[model samples]
Target: MKHEDEMRRRAGAESIAGGDEAEQLDQDTLIHELRTHQLELEMQNEELQRTELELIEARDRFTDLYDFAPVGYATVSDKGLITQANIMLAEMLGVDRNRLIGQRFSHFIMPQDYDAWYLLIVKLFRLNLRQQTELALKCEDGSICYAQLHCLPVCSAQSNAIRITFADISEYRRIEAEKRQYEEQCRSLFENMLDIYYKTDMDGRIEVVSPSCLAQTGYTQAELLGRRVTEFYIDPAQRDQLLSALLRKGKVNDYELILAHKNKAPRIASATCRLLRDEAGKPVAIEGVLRNITARKQVEEQLRLSETRYRALFEQTSDYVLVMEPRTDAAPVIVDANQAAFEKHGYAADDLIGKPITFIDTNISPEAVAERMRLLQSGDPVYFETKHTCSDGSTFWADAVARYVSIGDSNMIYSVERDATRRKQAEEDQARLLRENRALMRQLMQVQEDERRTLARDLHDELGQLLTGIQTRGEYITMHAIDSEVRIMGEEIVRSTSALFDASHASLLRLRPATLDALGLSAALTELTGERQKQADIVCSMRIDGDIDALDDMRAIAIYRLVQEGLTNAFRHGKADCVNVIIRKLPAHAGRDDQLWIEITDNGKGVHAEADRTPTGMGVIGMRERVHALGGTFMLTHVPEDGVRIEAMLPLDHSEDSGR
Candidate 1:
């Protein structure tokens, strides 16, 4: 203000001194100019002060933005030293702003990143370009953090520096690493999995296929890409169906269909698919997985065929079939029955189902049924014959076969029954006929024995008397004859009569053995053996185990006849040189009498093979008939290298009672 006052006084004096007319005018003008200039200077000074205040506020705002910003800002010198750092940068380094100044920026970097920082600084200076990199940095506390560094060149009057921005990105980097690892795992699974993974455009054209496509569809991944998905379908329409369903539901699971392999063979596959959408929610592609189901489909088909055949057989078989489920320890409940079972039992299916197994055959006790069920559960099958009562109250014999079967979750019994009523009746009829035949045979044998005895008596008595008289007359004529010729003729007559008597006696003995009738079976066998030995010039032996006298006449006759026939056949047909006969009595069995066993063996040439092949002759047949008539069994066998043997067994008690 003083200077301004002084300058004002001086300007006033100068202007007054020059105050003549022209001078006074100029001085007034100068004073006016000076006053105008003074006012202008004051206005300008106020404008400048206001402008300076605005600049101070702007600088304050700028400083606040740089120091407290979310990111750290710093200036590094050409020598890689920190020249300036914002409060954020200082905080990031866990150091005071003053402490950070003049510190080597590389020192704040991790040791492992030293070369990277050095290279970054060199590149910034050389290219004066902006660059960004991510690296780890060490804080003042020695803790490490990940940061993204963005560096740009800065030029100032004093020196060249690089301005750098640091962003803390540790959490982001951790998340990125995890995401990469997860993607790698998914890629591995997609490539190596057995199932095929694929992506298709909305037009059903394949855009991506995993490596498994080659093994699953017999098509290379390259061959599949860019091809219409329907091209691999056995029925092209199937793709349309799939798309329609997917459009309706937005996803499909286990949609099964047939696909044509590269070889043109059909393969079954199950697909799980979903629609892929863009950020705008518009459908872009279809992503899916396909699994080969050809083997499972084949197995299902086989099972279906097997079930069909089983049903056919079960319904068509003549034998009655039943399926029953066990009810704990109780009798099994009938669950199913075949056509035969329903018809034979005269019951409707509804009536039989749910009924106990014992219900069909009332004769079987509950305990017995339970026992059979136990056996069946143990994997044992039970077979038995019983009388079964039908729904109509009629009874018939049945043969039942039962076994355990498992169907799904339940254990059941499967039974097959056959009607045996006709068979049983036929067997009874056969037994009756056999008994009647035996009775008639016994009577016929008795009558034949009676006739033989009468013939023997007549031949022995009358024929012997007649031959004796003729012999005596011939002897007298020969003794009293006058001429030699007459005597010689009478001698020839006596010789002829003697020969006739001898032949008659031998014939009577053979027709009816008198010793066999009077003495017993043993004597008859002995005499018969002796005769065969002499007549056939062979050795014959007889063995008797029990007392022959104990046997009744009828039984004795049958025995004698059997023995005689056996010996005759052995000698005539077998051409035997030696014969042995044995008769032994066996002990009695329960409900049976003592049995007699007779065996005849011969040491002669065995019967001819051709004769054995031919039907049995009447002689052997007769022997069998006689033994059968006495309720005995007879067997005739040609032993290899041991001639022929005949065996017979007779029940003594049976023979004795029948005769009486």
Candidate 2:
């Protein structure tokens, strides 16, 4: 303050100066403030420029991510129009990206999924929440797209939209469906298969078994599972064999075993098994299918027993038995033979087997054997009589019965033969004896006829002359004597002589016909037939055609005797009227000799029921012998209503010089 007075005048001058300084200072401060504000403005401009560049880069990255993403992206307006869509979304719809804008999103959705899409969009927009759904989308090409979609509502004050993203799930769905189907098929096969399916651990414990196991093994599935597989085996060693085969070969096919049922009955089974292994190839379990073969096994055993019995019978029988296999290129060959066959053929077993049947058969040819085989194809048994040759070249007859048979898969002919040689020899001996007997009988008959002819000649020549001289002397005495007693005596003597001569003549004719020696057989037959007609009061007709008179005396005598005997039988036994006799000669033809045919037919009573008139009687027997002695055939037919017809055919070439 004191300095204020003294400085008042100085202060005024200082104040002016101070004021100027203050003003200059204030201006400098203001300039500095301006420079700072300008720097801040420049910095703000640089920051804005950098932020714009970053925003542009972010927009480009988002566009690329949205357009090229694996999943499809789309934006839909509240009206369900496709407001925006990415390249992936266009490709998913099989459409161009630019053309996708402003299209109704529901148009691309499958008609079946339209309601679902509508509900999803409504739920998203109304709840302002995210929604998920599966939809089948229709593409521009009209193909379905199985898609899993995720939707988000994009809402603002200006407009409402839904953002959607989807991925193709068709392949995943297909794989899942296939897995379900395969599992179902496996379950059905296990339950319904007829063969038993089983799984067992390495330690022989059953782990899994099918329902069919109960039917085959007579045990329930519950009883089988978790049990030792060897427990059911009748012989435990069989299980060991099965395991060994499975382990060594990794599999076994049709391995047979015997198992015991719960009731202790035997069960025959055939198993096809496989060894199950882990990825590292270590054995883990065994899986198999088992089939019940008990019935089949029983049938096989019965067949075996039957075959054994058949073989025994074949070896022990007395008849020869052979098995032959037929062929197309050659004759049948013997494949097997019984002991009897080898003994009968005089051959060893090795020599006869595999040889052709023709080797032993003397009567068969290869061509004939082939024909027989062809006939056997009809499955009929063939019976035949055949001749067989032995090792010593002797032959024998055999009665053979052959049958076509099938053994296993081979076609065979089985033959049973019996020796018939003795029977054939006996038949031949009998025929020879019959011929000899016939020849001797003919010789005896010829001797008897010769005796009759000699007796007849003696009676006619010697007795006839004596009787005639006596008769003439008696007649002369009667005519010349004068005494009454002498005349009477002469008459009586002449009468007695005449009566004796007539009786002697009648005896000669009865013993042997005089006409037979004088005339031929035809004339003698005529006289005998005429005499029979008069005696029996029957009509007898005769017809003779041949040169029969030229025959030898024996033949002529035979003809005469036959005619006389025939007339006597007709008059006595036949007791009828008309009789016909015919004799004719037939010319030779077709390698036959000239023959004489004789037929005698009579209208008579034929044969009597008493059997005395049978061919065994003396009269019929003599006639048959006479015809047979001359090597002729004789037939006599008797009809009760008609007549009796006798016919004889004699071969002329068969003379007595040739043995009958």
Candidate 3:
């Protein structure tokens, strides 16, 4: 019971104490503290929101810079995994930005670059330093791009990441390609000289040429570019022939041909053609070189013509032409001889071609032969005569000539022998005949002059005496008769006789024309024209056109006779006519008077067809000879309608002067 009472008392005390503790907490202001704590929490939340907003703005800026940078930027983990990639890097790799993240870096490397990349990664990790490498990256499109990459290794106690940057190398590759191509062109240009060069399009056309081609073909590059090779060749078919040869043997040799150009001048060329081939070994075009052989061809032609002419002259000479070799003694040997030699010496060419000259002449002096051989060797000409023996053992005189000649680039002697036997005989015979002919001509001229003198004496001396007797007798009879009628009759008879004698004297004078000597030729010509005009009852005049000082007496005489004869012809044959005679001094030569011209023209019935139709008529022949003998010209023509013209130009101061 006491224990129970104590426990209860203790319980009552504890309850009072607990109540005091609670009163103390209440007294310490519990609501105020709770409110203060709430206010503090609200303020902290507002400050946290403001800090979050600032962080968001800064993160956005960083993302923009990383994705859009000019060069690619990426973050890789130490395990060769790409943890972050910017937009540029993703594009370079041909992938989405998000897709490239968390990808193994080795997966993006080309197979060719994988080993090199492994080495680079090892260096980056071991040294923990910056590293660079050129890598070919395989993109998602299955294309490769070269890249220069720089990696910054960021290593820490807790993190594994490498910061890497990449640069595209497209422009660098382009420049490198250009440099290599230039070097290749220079090498080809140097090594390919002395050969034909060419370029072709996809078609089998030659599109470019070298300067050597122009020199070879004589055509410009522009001329040949569009033209086929066949067009310029003399033979168009040669192109196909060359093609066939190339297809069979893969090349053609330096073949000879006469080729014609577009202008048609023939050229000789040595040609070598080769195939221009493609990668497939098919021939796409042809390339060739041509060497000009025109000058060589010209030389060959000249040599041929020279050979032909000389051979013909040597073989067919009427003189005994021979080709001889010089001998040490006796005589030079005749290697060849012509037909004339055979006829001259009575030996065939076959007998002489290889024989020494002494074979034809047994008495030829060895000294003479030796001298001739020396002269031939010294390049001098040799000519002499020697007695030659015939096949019949008969001897004849022969003349021989030899000279040094060049044949086929070797000095040689050419020899010729002429048979002077027949020529000498003919010359002797001609001298005898000429002497006889001169004697006969002299006798004939003497006879002709004697006959002319006798006839003139008969006409003047004989007939003049007879006519004088008749005139004196008639006058005597007129005086003796006394009756008027008888005397008148006698006077009539005297007058008649006087008229007859006068007519006879005129006739005798006309036969020789005595007045031709006393009067000058021009004066005589004037008298003749007046008489013709009176006798023919035609109107006529004589006129001289130029100075007559150039006329010699003979030419002057010929002119007079020509006018007189022409007018007589006009009166006799050409009826119903008028006449004109003209004389002039013709153009001169060597400061001397040249020709004296006489032109006698008449308006008459003109020359008959019988007279002029034949070029050689009697009158015309005489006139032409008179002019031609003086080395002058004579021309005769019938004027178209009513007249004839006889023109004679006689050289003055000719031998026909002085009555010769």
Candidate 4:
């Protein structure tokens, strides 16, 4: 349109120039031509004015488009200053449009992004082509935003500047970063989780598998992908069953299957699966987690076998077994019983099934029933001796042991009753025999004491006196002899008589120590210890506590004999170097009346191990019998690396004494 106006203007000017020669020929024609020229100029001026208005409108449109564009546009001078900044550019920088003019563009760039911006600008000018870069830009409010800058170098005759267009891409970059992080997390879970995660296509061909599949199925991701899922199953039918379930239910949980490993070993697995469908809701693939359940399956099998064995034992045992359920009223109700139980009670199985457990027990008193209830409530076993009545109206003793047991979900009492009638009778018989034997033993011990006293008296009176008289006669003969040979014969006779007297005295002491009857227990023990020390050349010490002299004859005699036997054992058998005897009166305490403690210790080579292995020796048996007969406790211990010790505790009160 401008070119057409310019052509018309030039043609008018040429026409006027050509008409100047015609004006000299005719004045009137010249005036008319001037008038036409004037009209033409007026028309030309109107056209020019209209064209100027159009140009102004177009310029306004261009300015508005540049300023309101989605992207920020700016012209930057070679010095990195902003020569022109549109409204979007000012808004992107968080500044007013007028405030951005002549401002250094580099000021808006983050310090860390300065180098990138500088290099970008340099490249844009050096290549004189469009160059782009992403950088963090600082806004007027000190906030940071990520942006992509596209720059085109503008080098013209009038000015040298770069036109740059940038967009605020902070939100896009933020979303991209979040997406990357989510992908990383998902990848981590897929690779590191223990259970097998897999995806399959509609055809049952493996589409993808996690790294864990390698460990779960002994097949790597590479090996499993693109392969048929049924190929790994021990029975392909199992896969078919799984697919059928998935198709029918749209999902399956804890579905058991057997899959074969690379080594051809069958593995038990439990799978939880769901259908993966498209937008059309058609099942495209199956997604699931498969967990190894081999251990659980093995445990289940073992439990099944164990239950079988337990059932066999429960049915076949000879001891009567009763399974009863506890009730609020009366005793427990007998729910079931073994054949032995019915046979022992002389009742048909039907007769006892619904009856209370107390019906079979002849002596189930209220207190007994209460006690059993208490034990059951506390989850403890009940063990007691009770008599059970049979159908014949006769009763027998039974040792019943009942415990609370849980079978499935029901709580019941499992009882085993053994026929204890024979055992109880045998125990009574043994007790009677033991009493009779103890009575006979006491009588025998008394008789033995009498015989020993008599023998000791004979040796002391008759044999001792006779030996004394012979020694006296021999001594007189030696002193009054008239010849030396007769004197020598008399001296030899005296020596032999003296030896006989000594032997008789020693024998009398062994039979019954005279001091025991004459001077009480302490004096007798002192005398006995003295004799052992002298004979064995051992150091013997005695500690007699309390008033031992107050003891009666029977106790004194027993104590004297016990000490005599202990010292003799220590000196003769133990070959002890020192003997210690302690007799102290024990004060009465709860559960124990006043007692006497006699402890004898010897520093000797400890008692031989073989001696312990022996069932009984005469000396030890005699000591134990004497102590037990007096209702006392006796202990003989050979201290390791030390010596032998014999201790006895005899109750002072003889009211409960079995020996008497």
Candidate 5:
């Protein structure tokens, strides 16, 4: 604007001087000079008008921005009286713009801030430098607002006015209060919880310590603060690495570690760490919690030790170790049994599992086991046992200890079995050994019983028949060539001989059945059981399923012997009116056909072995060893209502597979 004014004045002065220097004035010359001077003046006036309009538009734009700024903006005279104020500042003060003008700022300031405001004004006047202050202002409505005000001397000395811009912080203050309340609640919780909580900077310095950490680590907050986290770690390097990982991954959980506390003792703890990131996703700090798991760690160690000690003990155990569950169905079902449990009771783990415990143990009746199942549904526990049968039809002794335990939070029954087969077998073998044999003494003690049976059968077949033939000849002679009295005596002799032979033959067959060798086990079992069926033929049929050709002789022999013993118990001892025997190959898996199964089922009086302890029985113990000798399993089941079932499984691990 100043440049335009100067140019207009120079042009006017030059034209006036040119006119004064002219002497002759022709009509045409005079007209041209006047018109040129008029044009110059008009151009100057237009230039001045354009400059004025431009200045007005620029001032209006600035004024609008100043009044409409988000923050409170104002201008004041040197005397601290308001010269101009934005609508925001005017509204904040609960005053109209017209009313706010010319008012002294000190009138709107809170009483407590009067001295601060005075000091700020003095600083701005003296130093002519920009300054900022936080102060409270009392609005016309009697409400107080927090603000950060920055003031600077904007105009020259002559103008003597100050420009101020400020930010209102009332909303920020409210949010801070809420956050502080939340932190206090968290602090209270940390002070009482059994778990430990902590926070750290990105550099691994422990910045915040929860009160629970004191109880867990015996360290004071002051002792922990600003300290490198590695200082308290049992493995300092591990601790450093974990912190670095948290910074990278943003979060980690279930991290196991050992920490040395103030007492200098290491405590096993599981720690979780989470990173606090900035808006840019870069880690700023870490927060985490820890739980002292020393007890659980100790338990794990003890279990490992137990397994080592029990490795050899499994073979030598006097009592069977059974993992059995009670019954299922309308009755109780035996679920699972270990090697020893199955050996003592004559069953396999797979056979017994998923069934009721009653299938094997008979200590508790089927009805009782059913009631106990109800108890389990109500989260209660019960104890019971039952007898079981093997696939080859053998019985066994077993004892179990069972109780409900937790896997995490789910409930499950934990059973440990102590096999009592050896003890019972030792007693039986001792009682029966001396009466059986001499040269075949210790080793032949078992075979002697079978030999006795064979001898009886020989006597019945050979000697008894010879005597009967002789008696028949004699009777014929008496009737034809002698007297009536002699004939009667001969008939009596023949009848007595027949009775004696029958008993001896029956005993011989029981000692050892020769049919076992003549035919496969399935055939032998069917024939042997057919004889028993005449007396106890409550069951309709007995059958075999699945491929059974891969079994070795010993395994076959074991199964056959088991079946003989099992049938005796089911028919003669168990008073079971009905029984079913099943022999089959196991489920076919790819590259696996090493398993064969034998199952004997009966609905009769159950042998209730105490679930808490092993019971006695030679058939049970013998069947157990036989199955075990083949590197397989034996398990027994004593059902709640349905009676007892026994299963024996053997693995032909050496047999070649067809990859079927």
Candidate 6:
């Protein structure tokens, strides 16, 4: 300001000294213009200062946007060093921004992606245009991230660098991989599935056919595609019907149709279809799955025929066949009956259909029927005999076979019955005749025993007295003496008479045991056993329990004979070392009479030595007949250990007074 004042004063003096009024006016005007110019310069300076402050604010905003931007940004020098990196880029590489600057950017590139990154940089600088490439980027923690890099080359006064933007594309790549895998799976199913998949246009022309169509229809893809679908149908009209249904319902499930194969054989197929429509919702094509059901249909036909045949056999059989439902709480209820059953029972089918089985049964109780059914539950059949009453009140026996059958969900009893009346009647008649024969045999044996007793008595009365007299005379002769020769003759005669008397007495005892008539059955058995043991040189034992002596005379004699025959057989045929006899009387009880039990066992080689052990001999026959005649049972069986045992149970009828 002082220098300008000095310069103005000096210029003022010079203009005054020149003595020109016009020059002095020009100096004053010049001074006014100078001052206005200075004012304009000051205003411009203030405007510049305000513009500088606005520029600083804008720079701060831009820096904030760059640091916080979602995309990772970086600047790489031509040497591949990171000259600048945004906060996002630093975070992407898992490094601090301060540590990221001036670092080799290639270090963050994955080993496998190094070449790609190098090529990308080369291409960016070579073209000097925006370039993009995908790379796998590695973080400091060794984790991988997929990124697409968009790079642009930048030139500055100091050096050249590449500006790059990183986009994370890991999720996009993962979705692409999953889509490819899903397509492959769909392709595999279409090619390898057993059922046929197909598509047809509105004109019934085949459009798409899966590979399985060839195996199911006997037509290759070339022959089937672009062909009319109805041409394969046995009845072309059926295709129209199916299409109409599909259009109306939007879908059809499990529709059956017959189609002609390439070889002219008929094929059964089950189809499930949907109507495929255009954007306007108008039906344009049909898509469906077709499954070959020829084998299944054939099996069903065979089963139907088999069932028909079984029904025929079940109805036409001669034997009475009936099916019944068994119940635990009641008798079995009849479910069905064949023609024979209806006729035999003299009832119409309607009458017996819902009736209990006991309706026709005469003697079988419901409990017994239930028991038989229970036994049949083991999956085995049961055979039984029962009597049934006819409509006329006459009963007849039936031989029945029953089986438990499970059909579907029902438990039933199937029974076949045949008339067994005649057979049972014959068995009864034979049994009665046998009883009569045994009665006659008992009478004959009684007669024989009486004659033997009479003979024994006669022998004891007349012959015994004569034998005694002869023995007495012999003694007298031995006591007296005469001439020597006469005396010798007398001694010889005495010896002979004594021997003859002894012989007569032995014969009498053999004919009839006097002990039996005098001492009762117990003493009789003892004497008989003793004599047999002494004669046979064998061991013999007898056990008589209860009051056997209380038996009637006839039964007592029978008991004696039984023991006698048993011992004789043991010695003669059994070749036994020992014989055992047991006899006991059983007291009367409910449904049974007073009885005698006799058992004869021997330790001898069994009757198997003589072939079968059946009682074919007369002695054995006599024993059985006597027991049976007295309404008893007889068994002659081989013992476990090389012996035969005879067991007899005889009912006693006491016609005489008890001797107990």
What TM-score number comes out for model 2? Answer: 0.50
Clashing pairs in model 1, backbone N/Cα/C closer than 3 A: none
Model 5 residue 409 lDDT?
52
Q: Which lDDT tens digits does candidate 3 get at residues 15-113?
A: 567797765555344445555666877788899998898888888888888888877898888787888889999988899988888889989888889
Better of 1 and 2 by lDDT: 1
TM-score of each: 0.55, 0.50, 0.37, 0.55, 0.35, 0.61
**Cα TM-score of candidate 4:** 0.55
- Evaluation by TM-score, superior candidate among 5 and 6: 6
What lDDT score goes with residue 226 in model 6? 95
lDDT of 2 by residue, 1-660 (tens): 343344345545555677987656655655565567668878988999999989998999998999899999988888888888899888888999888898888888888898998788768877898899999889899888888998989889999988889888867777878988888888998899988999999989999899997777779999998999889999999999999999899999999999898889999899999999999999999999998888988899998999999999999999989899887788789999999988988999888899988999957987888788877777888888788999889889988889888768888999999998987788778866667777777667677666766786887788777777777887888899999899898888888888887777656655677777788777778888887787789999999887888776656666666666676676677886988999898989899988888888898887564632534224655677777767778888999868788888877785543655
Off by over 4 Å in 5: 1-461, 464-468, 471-482, 537-540, 547-551, 587-593, 608-617, 629-631, 638-642, 653-660
Name the candidate, 2 or 5, with the larger TM-score value: 2
In candidate 4, what residue range of length 10 has the lowest lDDT sum? 609-618
lDDT of 4 by residue, 222-293 (tens): 888899988888889888888988999999999999989888899999999999999999999999998999
- The prediction achieving the highest TM-score against the true structure is 6
Off by over 4 Å in 6: 1-238, 244-255, 260-265, 270-281, 284-293, 481-512, 584-597, 606-617, 638-643, 651-660
lDDT of 2 at 342: 89
- True-vs-predicted CA distance for residue 101, candidate 5, Å: 27
The segments of candidate 1 whose C-alpha lies over 4 angstroms from its true place after superposition are 1-215, 221-253, 263-266, 272-291, 294-319, 323-335, 354-387, 397-427, 464-505, 589-593, 606-618, 639-642, 653-660
Q: Rate the local accuracy (lDDT) of all candidates.
A: 0.85, 0.82, 0.71, 0.83, 0.71, 0.84
> Model 4 shows how many backbone clashes?
0
- Over 425-491, each residue of candidate 5 has an lDDT whose tens digit, in order, gives 8867874553232223322433654565467567757877787787678567556756678777777
Off by over 4 Å in 3: 1-250, 253-469, 479-492, 545-553, 590-593, 609-618, 655-660
lDDT of 1 by residue, 264-325 (tens): 99999999999988899888899999999999999999999999999999999999888988
Model 4 Cα displacement at 398 (Å)? 9.0
Candidate 5, residue 274: Cα displacement in angstroms equals: 36
